[model samples]
Target: MESQTVEYKSDIPTKHKLFKAEIVAFLNTNNGTIFLGVDDDGTFLPEKVDQYKQWESWISDWIHSAFSVPVQKFVTLEVSAQNFAIHIKQGDKPPYYYKDGEGFNSKGIYIRNGSSKRRATDDEVRRMLKAQVANEFESELSNIQESLTFHYLQDKLLDNNIVFDPKGLRLQNVDNQYNNGALLLSDQSPRVTKIAVVDGLDMSADLLAKKTFSGSLIKQVDMTLEYISLLNDTKVSFTGAAARVENESYPSKAIREAVINAYAHRDYSLSADIKIEFFDDRLEIFSAGGLPDGLSVADIKEGISAQRNPNIIHVLDKINYIENFATGIRRILASYKGFHKEPMFIVTPNQFKVVLYNRNYALVDDDIQSWGNNKLKTNLSDAEQLELGFTVNQDHNLFDDSCVTELEKRLDSKDEKIIKLLRLNEEMSRKEIESYLEEAQTTVYNRLKRLIELKIINKRGQSRSTVYYMKANESK
Candidate 1:
């Protein structure tokens, strides 16, 4: 209990965060032994020996059920001298983490710093990665949630005659241990793709909509694309040569490639999530981490891609999520052809951003929206049309006159009078009905509300402007 590789606990911390955190810390740092049935002062509880099986089963279940990544092979338990010990070996895959009811603590990487344990700094984690020969973070084994389903992933790969083989897909290591990549592709993936729709350009602008997509990575991509597609309004220009020239505000191909690239090339090591923001004038996609060292915005524009998560890219490729390794930028650029504004790729020390300009931002037309009355056709009476020297096509009437004839047989005599007035005229205001029936406004209003519900006739306009009309179909 006093050694550098040993930690003492009088009992297993089943409900506390310390239980898994201590083991994960050991795996991320130097391998260590956790002594149960013993206190830090070296006091041993002999009764715990009888409950070793229960303790072991509980902990084993936690590691298996609670974690997404398979890391059971690295931890073991032994019992002797009234002390049950949990032996955690230093993992070949660094940065092991623990998850609780609240979910994964990405910053849970811990190390033994002499007498106690502490979180490993970014430098230490980077050093660990270097020592591990720069293994991609997605390739590292995890125990965040051991049980993962890939039904969505399987469907995507199914057409290619590719089965969901974790090992073959590099989602699992050679030992069949699922890595972070598996967690991402799994149906129970914890990774999230967040999007914000703002009324204006920046964070200071009003948020119009917000959505967070999760589950399988491929599913997230598909769903996010579908959502953006809905927002990317399609405009048709009738002015063009007999054929319709329809174009989306932003080219859909560019949006798909840009979104997939955000997930495929983003630095998975960073805790920050990929951010996609939709503004009135443009779309901005920002992923954690910049282009790999020695790569610049110019290189990216020239179609040079330095994949930070190649393993992730490979899985996506199997499902055709990517068109080609480095063609996303080129595709985005090509989409803006003939447009005055060009797409931009911004690279900072910690973030990589893609800004896509909107093509229809300036082409908004108010003439397309009509402020006409909500009627099937014109509000003019047949007499008015005839008086204006216009032929009122009797066949073009919205109301089926036969429909009013049928209602006459079912309505009360008082309601029949109102119905008769509407039948004589194309439409009638509430005041006109009240005047004809010589009834209180309240009585006429109640009759109209019921008639509208019965679907005998339809009501239009609002308040004093409200008018009732008999129609062949129910009002929307």
Candidate 2:
């Protein structure tokens, strides 16, 4: 639980100054509940009636006079047996203090982080103050055509045939004081500034292949899907001693999701444009924004959904362009159900990117086959293969011997995807793998459970929506 959910005690020095400091601490931390009038040992014994009234008055008087911050919003209460529960919520305003000429003197400015109310270090206080000011000056945009429709999303994205309402989209109940609203809804969106994309493996290539999407949000949606379609439909030929081979890794859903997330979660406040770049071997989507507050690519397994643009998310979820509060990173990992190569993510100071590589090719079908051949090898059935080709051909990349050497360093030989994914890309999602790798859903779950047991990965979240990511063997 966040710091804001505490059972209070009279043992907490209800003297005026200390009481005010504690209340301020709770607000700074996670908004928490405080129980008043309860003795240290959980007894319901009330204080003397006269003293109780005086204590209440003292509490009220100090709160009004002591804190420069607004007390009304942060403090909420309920009472039973003279025991009270006071709720203090986390505030957007920071560097808030309990005052009276002794500015941060004995009761220095404190911040609640996790469960501890530590004195705010200079850096923490500065960041909080900057965050407050940055939040206050967010840009606002007008002239959005209400009738502008995203019907075009349905036209270009073929793998998932979803429909949309002709009516435009809106983000309701957004706390404008803390959110960057206009940048997300603008027609140019990520296109306002020039976009650049790069291969994760090769960061220095100025002339690398890149594409741009133009027009309204609907038009941009179409443009992005059009680029994704090129990847989905592209085929590369590989020649083997056995025969000639053609490979098409057409899991369009994965590309769509990566693109959608780039648009939906990217920090539009930044000047950089969104980018879709295809490397010789991988496809990458770069969004200006890094992961939202308190989230990282590792959070893929955590199954946490923190959208930078809830209004945009609202419309995307409503029209089914994206799943409602669904985690996209998890879905991308699922796309590699029968394959060995996993997805990757790279996070930089102001950007977050998702990368998917072409599936590795194997010379013979059996060569790429997993340990279990019959029950779970490939998505294509015998009849499907027959229809696909009477003369099947195959080819494969040279085995990555270095990965094996890296693997041997492990005390135990466990080949879990979540582990493999982290080794390649620190952020991999178990839920995403489950969603895309539908055939191996149970197998993935079991593998994750075993990894967690072995303490190779840490599991978080609840139910079928849980997330799994790498954990140090010693960390657990």
Candidate 3:
């Protein structure tokens, strides 16, 4: 028997190019398949023998040499008559582009955008290119003594808190002119490579409060975390219904490791900034690069050291920013385990995002209440729900603010009926929700009140009116 999975497409030409781009995009970004010649959209164009044979040859030719690198593509027949499907799978090397019968096509590159084909933007193209480049630590940082300002770094470290011997941190070769620069660990050295804070709705220039570090990367990291701490306001609840609020879940050590790894592993040649997203519940740090070659998520867990930037690594070592030679990831995991939660380290082509989930001790003591007649679907606490809400809000590509808030509140209140309704249409307002459930305004308002108090749902608008919505975390 033949494989059931194949690339399926309708008779729509515009959609065909989009699907080809989608298949190409999936091959470029991660890996997936695209099927063509299927009549799912009711445009069942019968396959002709001569035309089918010609198209097959053309597709084969396109797949082999039409991309920056060859992506996998396969064509096969369906079980039905005159119907067929094509499968375009992803390959190991990413950032694949099509020749476009002339020059390179960037926007034409398609990726799976939730069951649809969407073109990649210019930013995505640059990210892909960075991912494709092979980075070796020793080879790049060999001539750092000559290439960068090592003396200035030493002075900065002495002036700051980093008490280390400069001789141990100096680059060996003084002759080579192309060595990667180093990061100093001094009180004056700014450990954060970059800091970006966005206010209001969109992540636009007007809403963004961005800052760059001029000192050594180590100091910049320290300064960035200090600023992040200022934004973190913690609130704790007790079994007696008493609430204590302060700056908690601010795991300084875990954050320091995350920043160190980000600075040490970032692709310096790239222009994107290191990202620090501060919200009400949690913080997200995104380094502008990914894991080094031959290193996977599993390898990171193995506590192996494959330094991507040797110059920066050497300087950090001297200052004790890195405690163990090969135990950064392990330490981070262990720290999170202590809190009864897991720290997330995500690997993207152009970014490494870390999430330090909040553990509200007070909320943990209380038993989880179900929504809609006691359907306990998730094992998340009240504080976890708030963290999930923050995660959903910040992740714009996944959901909007309203969706996440609603999901959390419904889960907390044991309102299962509303939870399913929100799952189908996340943007539903209080009125729409009332209409859908055929309930009274007072009931909906009371449910929404419970949600807001729990931090599961956030209220937008003002006066004698409002919109009640769920957060992305609620869906989970």
Candidate 4:
């Protein structure tokens, strides 16, 4: 009747060492209950349950004193008329040792091999060390303890006026050894970010560029962004009375946020590197591990952030690199809020990925209408149309005096200036525009009113909080 998670004993063991191993096995593996008055056949013997309270106290005290760590918290003794159950929950810290006399032995460590407890192997002991620091992985001692440097990260901290204190940053643990956090931020870190820019839409396309960035993770992220910026091309549109709209192929903020998210939350235990594939149609950032245990795609989309590597994110937050708003997933979605092409988040048991589509994917010769004869324009939003770089009106040239000259005449120098200012900033308050324009309040108001009527600019909010921006109804 006994299984991996359930054990029955007719009565308490005569020796302390025998029963202690059973409790340790439960802690190391999945938690199990040891029933005092239950036999192997699941037969209850109330006569065998004599002195239950004394036996319970004796077992609890022996476990607290015999283990290498304070494991009393993981143990619970439940007493009822039915039986005495020693309930041991799976421990957060592993390698729970049973001391022989005053000193602990490697053989003292036990795990549930099957239904029975056995001495753990050397490899299992090492794994237990990792589990001990699971919540703060950066505090785990580095594999390479010698010759680690943090020049790049040091300078970053210096620029931000923070002293380079390894102990203060938790780059070193209690033993004063350089921890995994220090290794990652050091100049000699083996971890690297790999990026492949495909010339075409998929991997079958020729390789336009391929790069590997190494050194400190902070440096790697910056270097990767710099290399990708060459591929993040911008398209300029010169039509419409509105100032020429200039947009990047992909949102810069979204790209950076995704990279940071991959870096901070990735499973460092895996040897696999962070891989980014840059294609004409989309960018996919593949991190080593999948979503944290119990996290779902919908939960992540709603800005629920679970830390797989808490210390790595903590360091980034201290450097002011983090957005200090919602999770990176939310910020990435915000970047593509008004676009038809949005980002996709994919997860497997061993992988987590972010796929961002190019906002300009539907453009042909910098014109959306020319792409399949405006087939893509049927359901596109104002922001999507703006990114494609064209005016809705028949007059293609915004600056052409003869083409839509009536509309141009209506937009005098002041209206043109307002439009130009709005183009620079996606949205500006009436006060912010007036501060920059330094013109009469009545004159600017009249120009803003006229532009809104023409729909050259859109007004949002009300009274003092009201803001005006080019390409009307973008928030839609």
lDDT, ranked from best to worst? 4, 1, 3, 2
Model 3 per-residue lDDT tens digits across residues 1-476: 11222234553364445435655755654433444454554244665333566556656766677666654343232333464455554444555666666666675665555555567778766655565553533235433243244444555567656644434455434543333443233333323355554332234422223456656565576667666654443443332223333325656667778777877787765666677764323467887777754356887888755666666676666666675477777777876675656888888776778877655432433323323312232455545544544110122323344555445444543354454444334345677667645567898778777656655456567754765556643554
Query: Which lDDT tens digits does candidate 4 get at residues 240-318?
Result: 4556667677899999999888888787777889999987788999998666533578978887666766677777888
Select the stronger candidate by lDDT from 1 and 3.
Answer: 1
Candidate 2 local lDDT, 44-95, one digit each (tens): 5555333455556666666566687557766765544455566677655666
**Rank order by TM-score, top first?**
4, 2, 1, 3
The C-alpha RMSD in Å for every predicted model, in order, reads 20.6, 17.7, 18.7, 15.3
Please list the C-alpha lDDT of all candidates, in the order they appear: 0.72, 0.54, 0.55, 0.75
| Least accurate 10 contiguous residues by lDDT in model 1 | 390-399
In model 1, what is the error at residue 75, expressed in angstroms?
41
TM-score of each: 0.51, 0.53, 0.42, 0.54
Which stretches of candidate 1 lie above 4 Å from their native place?
1-135, 365-476
Give the alpha carbon lDDT tens digit for every residue of 92-162 in model 1: 65666766445655666677766578887887777555434333677778776457788988988987888
